[model samples]
Target: MDLSYTERERAFRDELREWLAANPPGERPQGEEADYAWRRDWQRRLHEGGWAGVHWPVEYGGRGASLMETAIFFEELGRARAPLPANVLGLLLGGPTLMVWGTEEQKDRYLPPILSAQEIWCQGFSEPDAGSDLAALKTRARRDGDGWVVSGQKVWTSGAQFSKWCMLVARTDPDVPKHKGLTYFLMDMEQEAVQVRPLVQITGEADFNELFVEEARIPDENVIGGVGNGWKVALTTLMNERAGLGFFLQVRLRQLLDELVEQAAASGALDDPRVADRLGDLHVRTEILRLTAYRGLSAIEQYGQPGPEGSLVKWLWSDTNQMLTQLAADVVGPEALTAGRPWAYELLRARGNSIEGGTTEILKNIVAERVLGLPRAR
Candidate 1:
């Protein structure tokens, strides 16, 4: 309930801010590969400075920061306009999930590379047919002599092209129920059976991909949390996916708002009372998003589970981003719709905000049934 940071938290924030100040993230370059290489180099710098994966345990080559400190890490990154380290999915989702359900060997093999950005990781949980409903996924893994062979397709897989490993969930026992039949595996991406094809977004970026896995081999040692227990392991990844990164994203939204305001002022849109009113409303909403993100972290720390703010923040963020971009289109007019412009790109990219991570409709159901104790929408 307290919004002020404790002395220790403040000290932690101060140290990070000083480090970030000394090591500023310079301007990001053009082109996808160049941008990714730049981020990878930045991640390497963070690792060398011991800033990457700050939330992971010290034994795992991290700073062993508390949940609040981890939130601060993300907030500071966004505040500094630092691109999230190249291995964000690994740090935020894969490493934490492995800590929960991976074997000692698995941890020993994967954790170090994840922190150092040596071996990039991607997720393969969402198939075209079974994105929202994980249990319904048709990706199948069958027993072989000493491993399992996976064969199926996964869509919306970001970073797949450059990844070395995939946190994959497949149906290992089709005879049983859908959810119970699943198994999680650390499938190697370099194998011949795996194919990665980029999916171009409205912004003309191919940050997402389609993965065609045809009999891809995962050694028996890579089965995480044991076969038929994938749903639980996947939930760990999903929970981590939703938690700390909201801080960074909410901060980024604030940055975009500031830019929009400056642009509006330059374009004389500030003179229009209607434009001013919308910008004011959006600024208030973005601030609310920031506060609710903190609330969610506190709720989880205190109650051992997320409060209403968990799903609420994600849902609100998606809608707020969409709304903010629409207002940009209005204030900036023709230039906003012009191709190759930043505002035009943001306007188009905001369309995916509602669908990515988790859909707004699905998040609403989660809040209603799980947080509000309401009946199922079904």
Candidate 2:
């Protein structure tokens, strides 16, 4: 696999780097609301500069960037330490999923707001009982007059409080099999029927929310793919979820590793063979994740599907991040373990990395069955 960037690709990276240097997203505010507003305004700057939807088609108000260029865009964002737009679910998962399955009117109405951050979006796939086995979701939406009334509970919804729309999957046909009976809806989150309560994590922050949706009404026009085809449409969103953010995440991991290495060097821990060996192993593993992510991107761009590397990268990233944070605790000492410290927060947050997006165990199962051609574990 040729990993070298071409002249044009290098030029693209340079231009993006220049833009980020000029228009950096300054310090984030203290409160959650202020921080969200700060990111919203940053997204507005990206939209104005034609950088919001870098991977989107030019006809759809994006740059029509190549796959490599898209990776570079994310890399630069991480390198500059810029926060992702507050409407990340919209830009990454919702808009792309809509582009694949949305009608002309749907695209016209939804896509522009997503790019501009005028409307935030969130995912409503996971419930209290159905996360790993997403097809087992119990949330139901009954057909009403020219619409549907949805009622259920969703957990770990990242931006539900701020989102204007939710890419929701609910059971619309109970008689059929679980996987076949689902329907995808663009559920409106602003109504009285939808309630959001923050889930305070171990980090003492509510980065996620539990959505208690009661009789939430959705218009017929808001059905994403079709009735009983929600599973397929939701699969599209899930695939995008695992694939699109890999680059940004990998870069962030690299940054953490760099910081840890700097700390180790300052503390003179790297002189020990054990410390050096572990650090070396992490560096190699991190590079492997980066390379594997690029290979997966190439496979999708060329073959229209991902290889095993896609699953492997996420698994490696989560494991590596957890390791990095733990190593920081050792090298950076007590400060890293203290409450409210950035390292402490990262250490706690890394625990959920293995579970979010997809779990390590589930990914291994996918790799075993799909990639290794092994028999399914019954």
Candidate 3:
């Protein structure tokens, strides 16, 4: 199969590149507050330029672009070194889930705000005891009149404090099997009983939080799919998550490696064969990831969604990110011991790539069973 972009695709890439050059992001901000403001403004600019919601249908305030075009957009954004839109949950997961399963009124109400950056969203999927084993989540949502009352805790909820809403999953029936009794809802974060407590990371930043829901009420209309079909609704969002992989990772890895190479050369560490070999390995791995991402994009263009092959890309990316950060620490030597240094912070942050979204072990099992058709380990 031919892997080259068409003439129109090349023109599209050039157009995005020119737009980004004219509207580059300003200086990096210090805290989450500034970061959110910067990203919101950036997203608004993209929306105004007709660059946001490239994958959504035209009826929903998008450009009605094909999957290849969407991939081209991501590629150009990475090439421009642009920061991802701050409301990633909305663009990547929530919007798509709403598109597929939400009622017409829900989609009409939510998708426009998401595209415009007027509403930020967070994912409330992971619970205290349900990280990789998502089906084991214990958060409860019981029916109450025309709405559901939610009462439970969600841990590691990224960007919860600033979000206006959450794409939440909760167990509606405990007696049934783990996957069969859950429901998904679009939760409003402004309710009286909902509380967000920041969880500080090793970098001394609190991007993630623990959400406490004490009788948080969601209207029945907030349900994404039919009752007791949350697992299926969640799969839709998870599929979107898996499909959007490699863009951020590719951007981050490229920037970090460039900085590491410069630092190593200036510090005379590049002369070491061990360091050189490690950097070479990282470069090769990154190239493979790039190609894998392109192939996945190709599949999405042809099939309207990516296949399970995305698991390979996700697994490789998490492992490579960890390895490269460790190599950076080695190159920095004693400087790595300094807390809050870029290299040290990067190493600490890399720890989460393996665990977040889905754990490495879980992803491996997916590839083994789904891709390789391997038998269960019993």
Candidate 4:
């Protein structure tokens, strides 16, 4: 497949770059809340500029652009070094899931706010015990008169403390197999029964949280697909999550490569053959990942779904991130050991790349058995 951009695509990219330059994010305050507010305002600006929901249908406040256009938007966002939109969960996961599996009423109610960044959204997938084993989540959503009474805990819920809504998964059938007994709901975060306690990371930041639900009410209309068909609905969301994660990994790796090149040259480390080889390896890995993402984008444009190839992209991204960060630390030496440096924080954060969204071990299992038709390890 020729991954060359057409003249029209190049023009589109230029237009996006110009718009971003005109409305760049001014110096944001250092606090998390301030940064979040800045991101939200930036998202609104994108909406007003008619560049917010490039992938959604035109009737739903989006440009109805192709998958390549969506890819272009992300690439441009990275180029600008802008903070991610505060409503990324809604834009990437919730919006696409609703578009595919949500009811018309649900779409009408949720899609517009997501495009405008009116509501920040979070994912309530991981529980205290269900981080890697997602199908084993224990959150329960019991039937109430006109709604469901959601009661359980979700851990490592990123951005839940600031979100207005959450895409939640809960157990609705105890007798069935783990994957078959679940339900998905759109939950209100401000309800009296919902509690969010911050989870502090090694970066000395509370970017994730543990969510406690005590008889939280989820209206019947808030269900995404159906009662017990949540596993299918969740797959839709997970597929989108995998794709978004891959995009982030590529952008981050590019940033790391740029930094590494600068550091190596400044430190005269480029003269070392090992350092040179590592840099070359990272460059090749990043290019391969970029080509894989483009392939996924092409598939989405043609077939309307990225399919199982997304798992390959996810695995490659996670593993490459972990590997590249290790190389960065090695090259930076004592600077990487320092606490406040970006590479140090990045090295610590890379530990989660193998664990977040889905673990590298789990992703490898998926690619081996499901994608490659290999025998199960167990």
Candidate 5:
């Protein structure tokens, strides 16, 4: 596959780089509220500069960038150390899913707000009982007049507290099979029926939340694609989550590895053969992850769908990130373990990387069954 950027692509990159240099993000504020506000303001700047929603179609107030250009946008943003826009869930997951499955009016009403960060979004798919096996989710929704009433608990919903809307999937019919009975809805998070509580992590940061819904109201028009079509629509969101976010994540992994390398070199730890060997191995893996992600992008551009490399890249990234963070503990020594330090927090956060999105075990299953054409795992 031709991996080199063409002249037009290089121009696109140059244009983006120039814009970023001129409009670099300000220093992040101290508290979570302030930091989120900072990111939201940055998204506003991006929107004003016509840089938001680079992957969205032009008709939907996006740049209509090609897949490669979109990848470049995320990579550059990560390299610049810019925080992802506040409505990342909306821009990456909600907007794309709606574009595919939303009615015309839905797109008109929702797409612009997401691009401009006027509204934040969160996901409500993973329940207490259902993590990887999403179809087995027990969140229930029942018909109520012209809308639906939903009740369930969703865990690990990042940015739930700040979100105005949720990409919710609930079982609407228990009589049918689990997968077939589900429906996708954009549930309003501002209502009294919804409660969001912070789920504190080992790092003492509440980057995620638990969503408790008690008869939350969702209009019939809010149903995406249609009732009993939630699985397909949800798949759209899931695929976008895996494929679109990889660019930023892979670049962040590279940046972290670079920091570790600098730390190792500063301490003369790189002189040790074992240390040098491991460092070299991590560097190689980081590049491989970046390359595999590009290869997946190429496949999507050429074939209209992502290749198996999507799963492999995430698996590689999570393992490599965990390895990189562990190496930091060796190179940075005590400071890496001290509370509140960057490396220390990273070490703890890296622990969940393998389990989030899709666990390593689950990814292996997808690779084996879909990519390798092997038998399904029971």
Candidate 6:
């Protein structure tokens, strides 16, 4: 596939690059609330500039960008070091999935706020009992008079405290098979039945939360796709979880590696032959990742889906990011681990890279069974 950008695509990139250069994001604040507010404002600015929903259908106030241009948007956002928009879950996963499964009325009601960042969204798919094996989730939603009453616990939910809605999946019918008995709901987060408790990670941030949903009431109109078809609807959200975000994270890895190289050169760490060799290896791997990702993007656009041949680059990007951060500690020494420093925070945060999104072991099993076409164990 030709990796070269067309003239129009190049113009798109240049325009965004210029805008970002002129309006760089200010230094993030100290507290979580402050940081979140800053990101929300940044997203507002992106929307005003006609850049936030570049790929959403134009009829829904998007630019209607092609798939490649959408990829360019995330890559440029990452290269600019701008934090993702605070309504990211809504923009990337929620809105897109709604477009796929929601009725016309649902789209009209939800898509506008999503583009404007008026309503933040969070995903409530991963229960404490079902992280990797989502099908094993026990969250239950029983039918009510004109709606449903849901009760469960969801862990590792980001932005729940700030969200107005949740893309929630619950067991609507336990009699049928686990996957078939599920239903998707656009749950209102402002209800008293919902609670969000922050979880502080090693990075000294509470970016994730535990959601205790106790008898939350959702109207039948909030039902997405249909009852008993949530497994399929949720699949749409899961597929989008990594699409553009993979490109952003890969660019972040590349940026961190570049910084490491510059720091090493400045401090004369390059004198060590072993250190130099390792850096070279990392650089090669970064380039390979970039190439493979673009190739995967091409495959995804040409075909409706990225086939088995197209590797899930997020898995590799996660591994590489951890390694890159560790190397920074070695090369930069004690100073790298000094609290409050960018390198220090990055090193701490990298610890969860392998576990978050999906674990390496589980991802390996998926590849073995799905991509390699290996038989599952009896």
lDDT of the candidates, in the order given: 0.91, 0.91, 0.86, 0.85, 0.92, 0.89
Per-residue alpha-carbon lDDT of candidate 4 for residues 282-338, written as tens digits (9 for 90 to 100): 889888888878887788778887656666776677777778788888888887878
Better of 1 and 4 by TM-score: 1
State the lDDT at 87 in candidate 6.
96
Candidate 5 residues 1-378, lDDT tens each?
A: 566898888998999999999999978789999999999999999999999999899999999999899989999999888999999999999999999999999999999999999999999999999999999999999999999999999999999999999999999999998999999999999999999999999789999999999989999999999999999999999988865678899889988888888888989999999999999999999999888888888888899887878669889999999999998898888878987899998999999999999999999999999999999789
Question: lDDT tens string, model 3, 86-148?
Answer: 777898889989989998999989999899889999999999899888999998999999999
Q: Runs in model 4 with CA error above 4 Å?
A: 300-309
RMSD (CA, Å), each prediction:
1.1, 1.1, 1.6, 1.8, 1.1, 1.3
Structural similarity to truth (TM-score) of each candidate: 0.98, 0.98, 0.96, 0.94, 0.98, 0.97
Clashing pairs in model 4, backbone N/Cα/C closer than 3 A: none
CA deviation > 4 Å runs, candidate 5? none
Which prediction has the highest lDDT against the true structure? 5
Q: Is candidate 3 or candidate 6 better by TM-score?
A: 6
Could you give candidate 2's per-residue lDDT for residues 26-88 as a string of tens digits? 987899999999999999999999999998999999999988898889889988989888888
User: Which pairs clash in model 6?
Assistant: none
What TM-score would you give candidate 5 relative to the actual structure? Answer: 0.98
Error of 3 at 6 (Å): 1.1
* Error of model 6, residue 147, in angstroms: 0.9
Candidate 5 backbone overlaps, count: 0
In candidate 5 the C-alpha lDDT for residue 142 amounts to 98
| Model 4 error, position 348 (Å) | 0.6
| lDDT comparison, 3 vs 4, better candidate | 3
Q: Predict model 4's lDDT versus the native.
A: 0.85
